[model samples]
Target: MIDCISFFGLGKLGLPLAALFARSELRTLAIDIDRELVARLRAGQVPYPEPGLDDLLAEAEPRITYASEARGAFGTDASIILVPTPSDAGHPEFSSRHIEQACRDLCAALKARTEWRYHLIVISSTVFPGTVATRIAPLLEQLLGRRAGRDFGIAYVPDFVALGDVVRGFQEPQFLLIGSDDEESHAQAAALFRRIVAPGTPIQHLSIRDAELAKVAANVFLCTKISFGNFLAQLADRLGGADLDSIASALALDPRIGGGFLRAGSPYGGTCLPRDVDAFVALARSVDLDAPLASAVRDVNKAQYDLIERHLLAGNPRCVAVLGLSFKPGTSVTIGSPAFELVRRLAQRSVRVAVYDPAADARESAHAAFGDAITCHESITACVAAADAVLVCNSDPAFRGLAAKVAPDRRIIDPWGCVLGTHPGLVRIGRDQALAASLLASRRRKPSLRAVR
Candidate 1:
């Protein structure tokens, strides 16, 4: 059996994956170019606050070793390189410099370690369509001096873990999607996944390009559902006082329209959706496919964010308290987060913003957004204690409990619809951009807008 070695750069994607495999008692060599990160991991902890991950590393210290230098790290072992391949800010997938650099590093590693005839390199990073076929496969072929299927193996397995729920996803994933060029590579990739993920989680094997396409398309479809929800919410509002909660229930009876991921939001951001959709658009452009519908999914999300920004501006609240920052409900990774975007846009006004999240602080994903301008509160009650209005950015369960206790005089804007069963002073956006504005327009009145399970 070949020994295990891994290369990583993006601490968010790379750390957990490298740590997990190392924890399994495999002689895993984790490599990064950064000297500080190398030193930090060597000291038995990662910089990010992924749940249960610090503890996992403490347990796996003997198995996992961190390295700044790749001399001994690139031994004759199975190398799995996980890099952060992010798309550009454009609507369509537009950047690959990170992936290109990662490939170049891997190519150098391949050349240096030619002694290992049976090398298995897996791409766990997210990439645009045709990445493995156009970029990864050819690089491997050129470096190894052999055909892929006949001599070596490779797989494109996108990591589906979010920041806060990463450990949960890693320990108990929905399923594994491994894209391979040939049978040997597919089998090898499946075996690696079987070792890591839970038994019976099921691994789907397809062409490398197919797997890459599936990930981007899945994001597009999910974004489309979000936009469709927003569209329906608008129509529901114009129908002379209608409840979308009920209308959605009525529509969900149809088999085609499932009642999942169809909720409204400020907008989809933080690490995916926008960029993935952009990548898909770029891919479609390359392939000469007219993806108007897919393209609009991103446009709709952008408009949704703009609507939220306008609503906040319309209120003209002096002190706005933001509840969450991460893209999703669970994670603390706030890069390109809609809430962060909201905060930035809102800062252009004269509003002073105080932020709090149950799982977020200066450590995880809040520092960059609220360095010195915002106050980080210890609890949700403290976060909203002195605010004129509260904007619920993420759907943390803690916010729901705290929302009930919010003073009757203050207004609460729940963009994520965390308030399932409603209370006084709480407003559910529920995908209606207009309704979200209406909540900000009216003052605190009688407790009439209440939703129940």
Candidate 2:
């Protein structure tokens, strides 16, 4: 029974997992190199925005300890490495330097301990297929001067989580994937997951490399679904009378399809999906196997953005308000966000772009992407009030009432079908021409519906 656990890399995913472990009544130590971040956590401040995190942190505070050094993690019975394994330049493979360095530091801590005690080492970071067995295991064994399976148990147990819904995903994972060098290692990792996750959670134990492949494969499959939905959406838009929402909803009823990630919206973008697809493609290529489906998924996602750009530009709005800058709602991460890219392209075209996101740091993210070229609004109403067109990029709940906020002349480009009320200027991406024509006709009757540009 692992009563105490140490977590490496106290970033977005790491912190939440640590909190959950603490909430589960386990003594949890969270270690990070970032001094300020450690300071913030110790001060009872969350480093990032996550739903239910603050409350969870409060509940788990007594059992959770924050530390800036790796040595602080020495006494814990198990250590899970959750550090960033950033993608290598010009390739899909993730650089394992961060996790490697963490393992080295952890080795030093283990060496310094006078008494030898068995510890479970779990790699929770996403890595390439062969990373665990070839790279991580060898390096850890060399540094610690011990055998992985015998001296210390090691397992690759990547978390299947999305940024916005991480808390829920961690608490109630569909299934836990464990890749271990030995049976004992697998059981140790599974036991730890069982402690934190829901009762009777299904667990799949695989070889180290298989688990690595499964992690990326899962995301790639999801990206393929999203891209497929977008492709269907485009078909619906082009072939009048075809409804994407209805089609997707019907397709989702199939037991095999399972109805998740089938919604048609902006291209799939975030920290994980795009990168994972690219990595999977690269992984396939490394072994002389061509992944045409994965490649197509990537191409389709990029093309979806182009389609959106064309639609927004076609309207020729004097100013466009881009609502929801984050990749998706409920999180503040904006990496590969369609809204972020849309703002950049619109600004380059001198389209007068105004952006707002309820969760994201609009000013900071906008400045980082393009400095002062776009206006960041504090409120959604403020963002769309002056614009002739508003593009709701993400499916944030705050963006649902955009129809009531904007004037009838203001065009609402909703990709996610978030806007409910029927307004003349509301342009749904996947809707047929008849709906668009009706909206246009209503605007023409009003006579004040001239295009701003």
Candidate 3:
């Protein structure tokens, strides 16, 4: 909106941030290389599920425009690049292909247009240390034929918004971290962000690498806390057998350990944590060092998902009605989700998958990801209609409805312990295990998991 080309890649963060700018009457233009993605957005569609995002896109669409190429989006004059740097394989290995491709598109854009003399190039993506000066700066300046700070306004403002709560996060951000070349660029970027975030959300200024490292460290800490809970849960399972609630309560008493992420269902899923941990360790490995904690975090998460498979296929059933498919409740995004992984592994077996999610369109999701090979149903009833045993795949509230619906004679092998009421066929595995037992008291508090017989 400040008379600049806002280049955004990886629709995850780029879309929401662009929406924030667009809603403020900024005339924002968002670019994605995926032609299908462009078509969907133009048609008022969001492929992924995030709370409040569909509405946000609808509200921001009026002021927003889109293009597949940088000539239309960047305009060679002024641009703000928001390219996502994601991790892969629980290693800190980053794929800058998406980032570099966006930059190349921008470079062409700068060469093509001869309109404006001033070009302020700000990066709002996650980059590793020394990425800006060593990697991004040279490529950008060579493309623009200008000095870093003089001819253009260069800054690094890493995004901290989480996946599920992106739109709402724009309003009440925890903090804004910016790494700038000069005071003017910082001020301009700050003023722009101020328009989007709440009045009091502090914009902390630091060196470019520091800003990058800060974002990484923040995600690393969050993953660490969660992994710590998971590790403790394993220990609790060992001690309490079927009474993990006590261990959970005792841990909550420790103020240093918050209650969040402690309530374990499945391991953390979706796009962020796994790759973030990988990137953290990969960065360390590049320096001939190893990040043991981060490495363990990845191992634990992967192990949890793997364990679900071990427990499920142990007493294999033919028609397994998976309770939930999305990562967690309140959203339906199965990308890299543990439940989705479970479904995939389950599919490889002779088992037939009947998946239901509260928010996701079963046909659209299944077709886009795996096609008609996987079955889709409206309610748990349809999914469980012919099931030999049920598996609690996701933690959607709809699982509770399933608990109430499964007939008394039905046997459900819920790994997530969704169906509590005693029925003839409700054989929940992972429940007898020490880890599953500890969460028993914790599950009792939730109405959905109350388990009626």
Candidate 4:
């Protein structure tokens, strides 16, 4: 039983994961290179917003310790690295410098330990295939002067959790993937997961390279599904009377295509999906192969964004209020967010923009990124009231009643089709006809609202 664990990198995913370990009764040493972050975690203050993380950290406060150096990890039985693997500028591959630096620091700490016990090192960071066996493992051996599997263990145990729903996602993972070169290393990593995951969770063991590929492949497959759904929507729009929602619903009935990412909406924008697709393409290219389907999927996603932009810019509303800023609901992350990109475009066109999200961190991110170019609002009502048009970006349930808030003449551009009602101004991206023409025609009628569940 691994009772003590150390986690490197205390960013969005890392802090929650470390807190989860501590909540599971493990004495966890969480380290980060940022002194301010370390200080905040030390004082039991979460540096960012993650649903349920504050309470989880509160529960784990007694069992968890925060540190700015690797020395604290020496006492832990296993060290897990969850550092960022940022995509390299002007390349499809990730820059592994951050992961490499973490490994180097950990190696120095391990070498200086006066007393040594066999320690397990697991990496949960996203990486390109062959990175572990070719780069990380060799670097560890060269720096520490110790052979893996004999003196210590190395395993790739990436977590498949998304932001906002990370707590539930972690506690109820569909399956666990463990990649290691040796049986002992695999066993150690598997034991840790078994302890945390619920009973009957499927666990697969694979070689280092396969696991790396599997992670990227899984994300790319999801992106494919999303793009396919968008493709259906586009086809439905081109062919009149073809309902995308109904078509998707029937397609989802097939066991092979059980409705996961089948809902048609804004382009699949986020920190993971786009990056993983690019990585897959980059990997295929590196091996003298072409992944046309993957490339097409990316192109389709970009097209969806263009479609939404066209709808939002219809009639050239003097001021537009974007209801959601985060890529998805329940997260403050604005990276690769369609709404954020829309704001940028609107700013460039000198279209006054107002933005609001449920999370303050997301609002702050927008304020910081756009400065005075955009206006951030504290409430949905205020944001909608300030603009002449409203663009519903994400499918946040809170935006369902937005039609009631908008004035009859003003338009509501909902790409996700999440907003319900027969308001004349409501423009459903995949469901409605050419937005500008329809909006022009609808203004010649009376608007009324009545609802029943």
Candidate 5:
């Protein structure tokens, strides 16, 4: 019965969802306020670089339409709002202005309709708990002058897709969660997702408040796992004869602690994990509850970043190369990227830094972010060619086996253990012996102060 779908804010997540809906044989309309983005999308060009997005857009071109205004899509039976819910500046809460404006515009369009019928509105944006029920639902009703669950229905359904693998994630989700104010809204949303997802996909229905909390809670839990792994990695460094990779592998065997997000690497960064963890801590404090565990997770992550920076600085290499810029592999977005932060820190210390990423536009992104302070290279070999030290900040598959190619004399710092076995000049952060030896060798190679005198 749900044949038409309208998507608001067609950014990274929304675009793929819209394409998938169109691919599922539903007539889909993708709307955004950015005219340039809408123009590009209409020309069969993707505004952002996401793996498989171009192919999906092409496949759904026949059934998909791009628009710049919500008024153009009022004919659709359902609208899914995916606008940005940025974290408030100097606060733990999300800014509701974007979503609020989006709802107001949507209501204005719905008001223009000649006839009123049951319409479903699904919010796919991540918001603080009680946002849908307390804030959004009331705003929509006030604007449209219609009672919700009677004239219109609302559902909260946040997607759990990561940046690089969003398309594949939609096709094969571990579970589907729908939070609705009423059974009719829940059923309609569930029915639509069922058509798009694989048959028999597990779907859990809850109240709007629970769904909002669950979305952030899931991300916060993942952050905790990552921070715990980093803590273990630090322990391995302090305790002799311990390797984080080996220890993490052992921990993964236990069913309670899953294998995912357990890799000992750079501090977790990107759009979701870091901010959501902070938001969760804020939510706890808002209710007058102490979240020391969550707070500790953040503190541990900062320590991990500081540890890596300190290790990089200990080596007095005048020139250093960073091999990855984006937060993770398979996407070009550098928002909240550890590599970007590391590059900035190195530049601040007057260390000449060159960076590269196989998937990201390093030249444009790096230059825009750090302007003339850092050099951006197009390839891994070119980036490391002139540098005496190299840091593999991301676990991009392109960085695998990179150690075999680097000169034996140059120092290689790999926190993610992307490189294979030990090398004389290689220093793995979580493994102390290699790092100590690397430092010792560097110190011995330096000219003595007494000899200079």
Candidate 6:
């Protein structure tokens, strides 16, 4: 009977979800607080760059509507709040001001309605554990002057998709998690998702608090894998003749350690992984328990970044070129990008930095963030031409053949192993014997800057 749906907060995730809902033959109302963004969507233009999103939105435009207020969702069978729940500036917990504001507006919408019926509100945003049981549900109950299970239903089902592959992820999530204290509410949410997700997908129904904790724990586990891989790489560097890739491959065959994040290239740097790791640690401390493993995982990530920076600075280059800006190619989000962090660290030590990214969104973000401190280039060749050394950060396909194209005299730091056909100037992270020797050689003499010319 749930044929109509409304989405709140149409950013990268929300807008796509709305389009997918419409594609499923459900009338979707896409609402957001940003008038400019809403205006763009109305005109058939996507504000952000996501693969296949433009075409998907174009096809579903006939079934979707755009609005700027919560009132737009008035007649929908359900309203899913997908607003941002960013981490606190100096703390590990998430700030729920946005979620609370959205709920308050929805409550107001509920007040204006004359008919009495049950409306389900689903929260797809990431929040701290027990947030719904302690804060969100109580706020809604107090505001609407009605009980949750009797008059309204609330469900917590956070999205587990990456930025670049969000559209496909929605169509085929590994599993569907529906969390609600009310049995009827849980069944209703599950039924809605079953219509959209691929067949045979596992569905788990749990209490609201458990679902909140599960989301954070999942990301924290991924971080542990990445940090462990980096640790092996560091150990390999200390003990010569041990290739990290080969070791990873051998371990992956065990089935116990699959190749998800086992082979290390760079530190795990994104909006989710690092933040969730910290949040999990903080959550443990809040309960008077110590999360030493999570703490070590965080420390290992920092050490991996430091290790890369130290190697890049070994030759004391006057200027270095960074090849990638986005966290991992495919998207333009640079919130917790390791490449940006590298540029910042170099700038702090007075090393001039020039950067380039094939994605236009990443270029704009980098230009906006660093301003005059760093130079942004249009092409990979131009970016490399401006510096004494080149650092290939991400495995963007555009970066292929860079090793052979760049000046042979200039050193190239390729952490991701994107460039094939090794040259004397080419160096890789986690599996290069040349790096140790190069570090020793650089210490003996000052490197010439003429290689850049």
TM-score of each: 0.85, 0.93, 0.82, 0.93, 0.94, 0.94
lDDT of 2 by residue, 280-354 (tens): 999999999999999999888988898788878887888999998888888789988888888878888888988
Tell me how many residue pairs clash in candidate 3: 22
TM-score, structure 6 vs. true: 0.94
| Candidates' C-alpha lDDT | 0.70, 0.86, 0.69, 0.85, 0.86, 0.85
* Candidate 4, position 210, lDDT: 94
- Collision pairs in model 6: none
- Cα error, residue 305 of model 6, in Å, equals 1.0
The 10-residue segment of model 2 with minimum total lDDT is: 235-244
Tens-digit lDDT track for model 1 on 167-253?
668768777999987887887777766776887997888788888888778878887888877655444434322356666677778
Give one digit per residue, the lDDT tens place, for model 6 in 1-453. Answer: 688988889988888888888888899988899999988888878888899899999888889999999786668888889998888548889878899999998888877778868888899999989899888999999998999988989999888999899999988999998889998789888888887789999998889999999999999998999999988877766543245777788888888778888867778988888888888988998999999999999899989888889779978899999998999989988889999889889989999999999888898888888888889888988999968889888878888789766888888887666678877777777677566456445645755722421
- Which is better, 1 or 2, measured by TM-score? 2
Q: Which stretches of candidate 5 lie over 4 Å from their true place?
A: 360-362, 432-453
Residue 77 displacement (Å), model 1: 3.0
The candidate with the higher lDDT, 3 or 4, is: 4
Clashes of each: 5, 0, 22, 0, 0, 0
Candidate 4 lDDT over residue span 1-453, tens digit each: 578988899888888888888888899989999999898777767787778888988998888989998887767789999999999436779777888999888888888788777889999999888899888989988988889888889999887999888877887898999999998899999988776688899999999899999999999999999999888777655443245677778988999898889989888888888889999999999999999999999899988877777877887888999988999998889999989888988999899999999988889999999999888999999998968789998999999998788888888988777888867788787677465345435544525311210
Instruction: Write down the lDDT that model 6 would get.
Output: 0.85
